[model samples]
Target: MASNDNDNSLIAGALFLVAGGIVGAGVALLFAPQSGTKTRKDICRFARKARRSAEDAVEVVEDFKDNLSDIVEEVGERATEILETGKDMAYGAKKKLLKALEESGEQLEKQRAKLSKLVG
Candidate 1:
């Protein structure tokens, strides 16, 4: 969800920048005192540059999205590995505890039997 929000914000920001560039270009063309031919050429150049900038921005956003996805995947894999290791360690400890308990019970039984035999 947070990633979704970040993606939305990035797209919105890009759109705003493009919109602002277009408005500024329009205002500049209106106020400039150049001949029609020169103005037309300038407009064409501005359009091309704007297109390139927009394309570059898109590529940057795509790269960032891909990087974020890869990092998330790696983190998930690491967490799973850690969880499995923890489970294996716990199982080993439990087995050791049960074995010790069994041995203690057997010792108690032997001591009780010896004491009864001596008393009788």
Candidate 2:
């Protein structure tokens, strides 16, 4: 869980960096006062750079998703193992309890027969 938070923070940081870079470039282009054609070219080049950055971010997200899936699978398998272990322990305990009860009943019957013989 802590790692997820750290990952989210990293992703947010990357997004902020990308946004700041785009904003900085726009401000620079607007303040430079170049010819219209040159300004358009600069904007196009910056757009390409932004696209690549976005693609890289997307790839990172995809990889994160894959890793998360694997983690979930591992957790699920572990939970199943824990559950089966608990069930096996419960079954053993139940068998022991039943056997104890049966023995206790036999001892009680023997005691009652002895008391009847003494009273008679």
Candidate 3:
């Protein structure tokens, strides 16, 4: 659980870094001297790139979330299966023990009857 939290934190940090870098680059471009038309075009290009990068990051995050959910569900199913199997095995063992006990009791009763007949 701690590891999962760490992984999530790392992903968040990486996304933040990418966003910060894009913002910093845009700010730097704004300060640089250039013709008005060229500057506007550059800013527009940078904005578009940043938007695309953000969208990609969001998609990656969504994919990670989906995969993690699937893994959790799979683990839950496996655990349930293991529990049920254990229960079944225990029940089977109990039944076998009971059958053995009944047979032993019957045998002892037969032996006692035979001994009484001989004594008589």
Candidate 4:
């Protein structure tokens, strides 16, 4: 998944570089003493293409953001469930220990009473 993101970033960067180059070339042409009408037309065309490319890039970034958010939420939920399960297990173990201790104490008291009866 990380590699995929890296790949996407690289592709987006390359596309931006190409778009910049196109705009730069168009600007250079516009300044090179061309007919005013032709220069305007060329600039308009380049502007439209650049706009489309930028919108596409925005869409890609939005999709990546949404997917990352979903993954983070899922991980958070799983972590919470695991924590709850651990707490339940700990509580059960503590209860079992307390019960065992109570039983042992009762047995000791019974033995003491029997011994006292014999001694008295």
RMSD of 4: 7.0
* Prediction RMSDs, each to the true structure: 2.4, 5.8, 3.9, 7.0
* Stronger candidate by lDDT (1 vs 2): 1
Q: For residues 53-102, could you state the per-residue lDDT of candidate 2 as single tens digits? A: 97798679769868987998999999999999999999999999999999
Least well predicted 10-residue stretch by lDDT in candidate 1: 22-31
* Top candidate, metric lDDT: 1
Question: Please, what are the lDDT tens digits per residue for candidate 4 over residues 2-85?
Answer: 957875786678577768877787869777887999888888887788778777877777687778778989999999999999
Cα lDDT, all candidates: 0.91, 0.88, 0.87, 0.84
When sorted by TM-score, best at the front, the candidate numbers are: 1, 3, 2, 4
lDDT per residue (tens digit) for residues 32-89 in model 3: 8988788789988988888888778878877887888899899999999999999999
TM-score of each: 0.80, 0.65, 0.70, 0.59
- Number of colliding residue pairs in each model: 0, 0, 0, 0
- Ranking of all candidate structures by their lDDT, best first: 1, 2, 3, 4
Off by over 4 Å in 4: 1-25, 32-38, 110-120
Write the residue-wise lDDT of candidate 1 on 87-110 in tens digits.
Answer: 999999999999999999999999
The better candidate by lDDT, 2 or 3, is 2
Candidate 4 shows a clash count of: 0
